[model samples]
Target: MVAIDANEVSKRYGTLQAVDRVDLTVEEGETFGFLGPNGAGKSTFINMLLDFVKPSHGSVSLFGNDCQGEGVAARSRIGVLPEGYSTFDRLTGRQHVEYAIRSKAADDDPIDVLDRVGIREAADRKASGYSKGMAQRLVLGMALVGEPDLLLLDEPTTGLDPNGAAEIREILREENERGATVFFSSHILEQVEAVCDRVAILQDGELVALDTIEGLRETMGGGTKLVITLDRLEDGTLETIWAVEGVDTAVATEESTVEITCTNDAKMDVIVALHEAGLDVLNFRTEEASLEDMFVEYTGAGR
Candidate 1:
């Protein structure tokens, strides 16, 4: 089932276009990542989908119904963890979530939802006293309380530590397994690569790329980087290294180190050639190009 669909959605602010013509569809039971650099219109596009911001052109549909035409009926079936969500400072975490559920008229147990987000112990603490990460968790807990069919998370792990980030990823994975579509936006390319089934990359308010993680890697020319440590520097090393058919580029370092970048299929060939060059190679290791590098190459920025 198509949980979310945006066709030729366009949003503009005066003369500047925030979200240019774009098309996106998220299937049920999949984690679809909306990826882009800052000011790339990711949040604007998401806001249009949520009907928080109306589009200048085109339309957005949720669960086969037009999102913009409805009176919160479609919205009731979806939950959102919006970017920069703020809660009442005086209210405790538990109260915040319960209040959201009540306001939404959702039928769910707030306690169980809070526990699922690993914020049970902090539920009694005031929102003003919560850490940045904890505040994020509380809002997410509120989003889950509705048990909606789809979840829209914008930079959901921005304030989380490594462990909290991993925990949230796992929870989203479990939610996907249980048949909820997760439409998420994040500047963290590695997180998208690790958790998302498919991704759409926007640049300068335009959809520049869309595909599976592996497919995007292929499109970006997947490669492995090799860093070789030598016992001592050698003369004519650059020329000798370039002699290997598959070595794309090589840079020699002052500390007797050379770094070679090549495709995966060409790595072993380059390694063997390095061994035969009469150079005392102390050690060698291969580093693969991560999704982060691919994102930078495509989006022209990193977060």
Candidate 2:
């Protein structure tokens, strides 16, 4: 069964079209990543999925239930960590978790949930006195209370330290393993790259690219970039490097270093050719194009 589905989904406010006509599907048991820069309508689309904001046109379904008509049923199976989520200032951290448990009719222990988020010690403190990161953790723990079939996390790691972010990633992995479908939405590429099965990039409120990471690299004509540091550059080195099979572009970045963008099969050949030319190969490294690079290319952000 598809975990989440949207057809021709669009949202408009006055003269502004927040989300353009877009179709999306996320399969069950997969960790799908939704990526876009700020104001790209990611949050708007998420709101539509949760029925918090009605779409101007199109339909959405959660776990095969009409999200709008069957709002209660659709939402009952989902846990959400919304962007800029605010907790009651008077409630202690433990109270927040307990409230979620009561709402879901779940038998979860508040202490256990707090421990999972690494905020157990802060459980007795009121939210009004909590740090931003601590408040984020408390809300995240609330999301975990019912162990819902789907998790909708919007910038889940915001305000978190590196260590805290890592902890959240680990928790996501555990939840996915327990048969929950995760929809992770973030503008940060590195965070999603580590855990997502497939990614969709939204540009200007339109779906620009949707593919596996490897497929995206191919679409962008982005292959591995090999940088070779050598003792010296030979007279015919550039020409020979270009002639190598699978080599796309070769240029000298420094007096003694050459950068070559080529397929994996051609990387070793370039090194051998340089060695045969009597140049001492000091060191070499390979760099892969990241999702951020592809996002920039597709959105024309780099232009």
Prediction-by-prediction clash tally: 0, 0
CA-RMSD of model 1: 4.5
For residues 28-143, write the lDDT of model 2, one tens digit per residue.
99999999888999999999888999999999999999899999989999999998789999999999999999999999999999999999999999999999999989999999
Spell out the clash pairs found in candidate 2: none
TM-score of each: 0.81, 0.82
- Report lDDT per candidate: 0.81, 0.89
**Clashes in model 1: which pairs?**
none
Q: lDDT per residue, candidate 1, 254-299, as tens digits? A: 5798776556777677667766787777888988766665666566
